[model samples]
Target: MTVVAPPTLAPPPPPGAYKDPKASAVASRAWRWLWLPLLILVLVIAGASVVFIVDLDSSDTGTLNPHSYRPDGGNALRVLTEQYGTPVDTPSTSADALKAGLGGDVTLLIPDTAPLSVRTIQSLKALPPSTRVVLLAPDRGALHVLFPDLDFGDFPATSPVAPNCDAPEAKAAGSIDFDGAGYLPKTIHAAHVTSCYQGGLLLVSDSTGPEFALLGDANLLTNEHLTGYGHAALGINLLSTHSRVEWLYLDQPESASSEGGDGSQALFPPWVDAASLYLILAGVLVALWQARRLGVPVPEPLPVVVRSAETVEGRARLYRRAGARKLAAESLRGGALARITPALGLGADPDPRALIIALAQRSGRTTQEIHRLLYSPPPTDDQGLLALATELDRLVDDYLTQLTIGRAGADQGNNPEGPQQ
Candidate 1:
């Protein structure tokens, strides 16, 4: 018995059949290698974020930090004082200042009052009558104890103002930088206070008792503004009046441990505990609700089927939107060549020159023109790409038509139609 082979409709798809993409791509060694760098990048970013947050609360690195020479630092002022023979001593806490200043001859300069504990405030008020206390604008919290008769109010900007009264420091400094803390003297004790800079009482001095001096703002002493107005001279004269200077810089907020306290309840704010309880109750409710519906997962085939052609179109649209005409033209040329190769009886992976020659002979086109169409450098713009695509489609169609006609003629010649035999 004799058997005839079926007519070839299309070529086999480039060796391997359509394979489902590996679902375990993430588990593959190549993917594992790619993820290592990404994981490292994420860890690096997280570490940087934590460092940035910690740096935000630092005082030694900030403008007002005595040791820092940065634009905002008090390094210039510190150097100036040391030049005048009275070196600035930085004490970590209020207790350290009190211990050093107990000699009465030592001057205590509290640059910031944010970290002052309840005990520190009380101890400062009862310092030796001989010790002088210079405080840079104490916040509203410390104002009650430090300035018993002063009311905290808006601090408005003021032009260079002279010391109108007999206060020697004010008069000697002559037109000083007075844009500082505003104080409203409310009681009989505050009547003796010397005020300056409009509403801002830049200095409040009491010479009879433990002398206390209040500055309006700390900016006057920073490196950026130290040379402006009479800031440098005033800051130097004010800090150097004593034999020794103790610059008390409070770094952190008053801790519960320092107050002799323990446990989260005492350490953290009350609202934090209440919020945590609500969150825990919500999580428990969600868990209980989900537990009722939990069961063995049922296996099912995918309901929707997406064709590779749809993916190709989507990628093409993206390339078009991004103006990636060169890449798009190359893809169009590759696809056209892939289909044209089989239609011309040239097997897969045929040499480009040979394929062009064969296509030219069958389609009655020049070899150079065919070569340019298939393997030319990518088109410059979208318009050129569109024209190239049209040419490629026409070439493929012409070649396919020629192939069909040639095959029909060969078939007829092979089996000749003889007279009725």
Candidate 2:
């Protein structure tokens, strides 16, 4: 009996079979992410270029050259955030200062907006028990809960100066040419330091509740501003004097900061750990080998990264097309001989077959002596190269004598003695 045919169900349409206008709009909007951040970053950086130029060329900014910045120590903020333009606060401490005289807690704040972040609050709260709070620019009514008795001495934000440290750092302190220029102004009024509170940071110390030493200027830290500014010397003193120093580089816009370093002595790279002597030797060898090779010259310190497999693959394609298999084989053979012949102390250009014959002759080896080893056929494919290696290894024992003296009687020694009597 014949069966009746049934109708088949149609499959559901593929995802988004019909492009909804809303969905299309969303997809189009998503593509903007590919370039929007980059475009905005370019614009921002371009705009920031002016600040950089001002920091570099203007007087009272560059800390490296005495003429760049006035000897006034008051505008430390401008020196930090505007002058040198380095991300880290240059007014804080110098490396030498850190080693020579650094002492006590180093507190700093770069503030923005009225509402302090909870994380910042927690970090400030977590200061060591013996630390003191140092308010750079404390805004009135903003941190009333934290600093009720803060001494606001109404210090001026800036002071006039020559191209060097012109005054004592404090009433009792001696001034040092922190920047290249010898002139460093005496302590500017601390009010400038308190101003950062208007922005966001409230650098607090656990030891000193209210009367902490305040540095009003951040100009010493900016990359463009600090070069000629006495910023460098000021930092050195702080760093040298402090027992333990911490650098918290805050990204004001992001309300985030990162550590320049934590306590650690080893500056070695991770690759220094070698598993064995061979590994250590190999690593050293690789480095030495690389150092000797003069690759493409680069103006900067950045390395020239290469993909070996890709390069080889490209070369291999060319080789295969040109049918240079025989030439390739000869080149490999020459290399093998250079290594093997010298190792055995044989003639520099000793033929493999001739060397084998000489070994057989010295030991009085019969035609049947290791016949399989000597007469083994070369493989037909690319694997033929392996046969040459395997046979060479097998003959090394019989040919040792040939390498040292001369192979005159190796074949007889290796031959099966007539009957084993």
lDDT of 1: 0.70
Q: What tens digits encode model 2's per-residue C-alpha lDDT throughout 341-403?
A: 565446664544454444455433433332333333323444564555455454554446344
Off by over 4 Å in 1: 1-59, 152-158, 186-192, 198-209, 256-421
Q: What clash count goes with each model?
A: 4, 102
Supply candidate 1's per-residue lDDT for 403.
72
Candidate 1 local lDDT, residue 237: 77
Q: Pairing residues by index, what is the TM-score of model 1? A: 0.47
Predicted candidate 1 versus true structure: per-residue lDDT over 394-414, tens digit per residue = 988877877777777677667
What TM-score do all the candidates reach, one by one? 0.47, 0.25
Highest-lDDT candidate: 1
